[model samples]
Target chain A: MTEIKTETDPSGLVYVIGTEEEGMSWIGKESTPVEEPYAIEIRLIEHFAEGIEDPNPLYWSDEYAQQTRWASRIAPWGVIVLCKEHKVWRPEWMEDSGGQDTFFCSTPLPGNKLLATDYEVECYVPLKPGDNVFINEKIIDIKPKTFSLGEGHHITVENYFRNQNGDLCIKDSRTVFRYR
Target chain B: MQLPEIKDTYYEDVEVGDEIPEISIGPLSHTQFLFIASSHHDWYPGHHDVEYAREQGLPDIFMNATWQHALFQRVLCAWAGPNAIPRRIKYRMGKPIVRFDIVKARGVVTGKRIEKDECLVDLDIWLDKQDVDKVTKGSATVVLPSKG
Candidate 1:
């Protein structure tokens, strides 16, 4: 087994550097389920809606939402992506350590720069407040190619977000270009 | 903020070539970018720090993929009304949207079908910057209620 090398940037984002062979080896690998630190809240949903200037009453007024098929103030479908927990405050134990490890950032790929090129999402059900959300991600594809930025690979990761009852809420696939 | 009175778009009322009402987002400034970044919990420096973005070869701090996705949803839902449900969305980023770039979301109905007793409409959607550059392009599937 080759030793895996990693680098952390000033923002605490981790990058993996390895040979093409090592990169190919990452396909089909799945990350453990990561649950959001807290249950979905109405305030968080409103905050996201406000940021986008979306005034859909379904995402705002509980009274209005109660009259709809959803029966409650449900979040916008796009909020599924925001439900993932990214550590902003370092934990006491890791106060001096780099950022928390995420599957995409820790993939064994040779890249100093990363850009999201494509995004696809399918929603099965609406996420509501008090629902506990969790995600499980898998590396589905890796294609090495030369691009305008430089020589690199396009890695596609598929993420599954489910609610507390294990009902899948969203299936998202993101393609990111990792270049030099 | 006052919510707009929107008319719901029923599947029976849509035609194959009907265009959704276009909505413009910005000439985005740092304030908007910061709000979006913090709301999404994406603390990527390239999205907020101009110096870091320039160092990383970006023209300037720009909007992230998730923000663009939300913009698409906002346009779709705004046109289709609260009853419509977004089934799927697939988009590809074309150009980086930096500060002072106004993005407009537009869509045209391409097809419609009934699957599992649900009325589904397919549309081609995109985000254009400054009415010239197509900053992002994609397709989406939405479920709209039937007048029947």
Candidate 2:
């Protein structure tokens, strides 16, 4: 397997995955685990519920959640990804790099434009308030495909979320169509 | 905000071809989009900047992936009941859900089975824009409590 290298030029950041053979090398290469900046909190959970206008008692009301199996307020299943999103605020010295740089985004391909075409998520445990989360991301697969938009590759990336105790909480995967 | 009554759904009570009550949310406005974007902490330009989206060949700003997933969660869990556990959710994105598009999330029971002493239900789920075009479509697997 070829080791793809990342390079930066005056034009900006450039990641070279090389040929298809080189791109294949990225499969199974996992990134170091990164802990979420903040622990899960009821306020944050309710804020997300409000954003989506979801009135599910499980996400907000402590009394209603207490009656459920969890016996405590829990974050919505969909909010699992949001909990691991890149921190919005960064140090002033840090450059605004658009968003968190992941192997999937930096991997060089024929197409520069990207679109998320598919997603899959499996919840192992309910994300409860006060649980600290850590995430490990890896490239699962890369395949050549032609779409109506243009020719590109279908990249599948999987994200594994775990609690501070190392118990897996959610396994999420997304397939993006990168086309010219 | 008032909490809508969500009936508890049991595995024994569900049957193949039963439709989950659809949830409609849309004619989405800029404020709503910003709220979601901010909450998710997604600073992706295509999700918030109209000019950036146009530069990327999109007509206007659109919902992010996380927001799309949340739409399905809202509908499925509400119908499955509070005790139900969402084991898996998968969907394919079709047309871009841009601003002002009225999107509706829906699901139907496709099958059911018992695994590891847990009752699991399979559902085909989708999101439609204006009750016409499907902007997102896929399937989900959930664990529901049994009456027994």
Clashing pairs in 1: B26-B102
Q: lDDT of model 1 at residue A71?
A: 84
Query: What tens-digit string does per-residue lDDT give for candidate 1 at A82-165?
Result: 665567775687655432465567888787667899999897888899998888899999999788778888989998888989
lDDT of each: 0.84, 0.81
The estimated TM-scores of all candidates read 0.93, 0.89
Instruction: State which docking tier applies to candidate 2.
Output: medium
Candidate 2 lDDT, A72-109, residue by residue in tens: 98887656555554654579998764435666667766
Error of 2 at A22 (Å): 2.5
TM-scores (chain A) of the candidates: 0.89, 0.80
Off by over 4 Å in 2: A1-18, A84-89, A93-99, B1-6
Q: Can you tell me which runs of candidate 1 are displaced by over 4 Å?
A: A91-100, B1-6
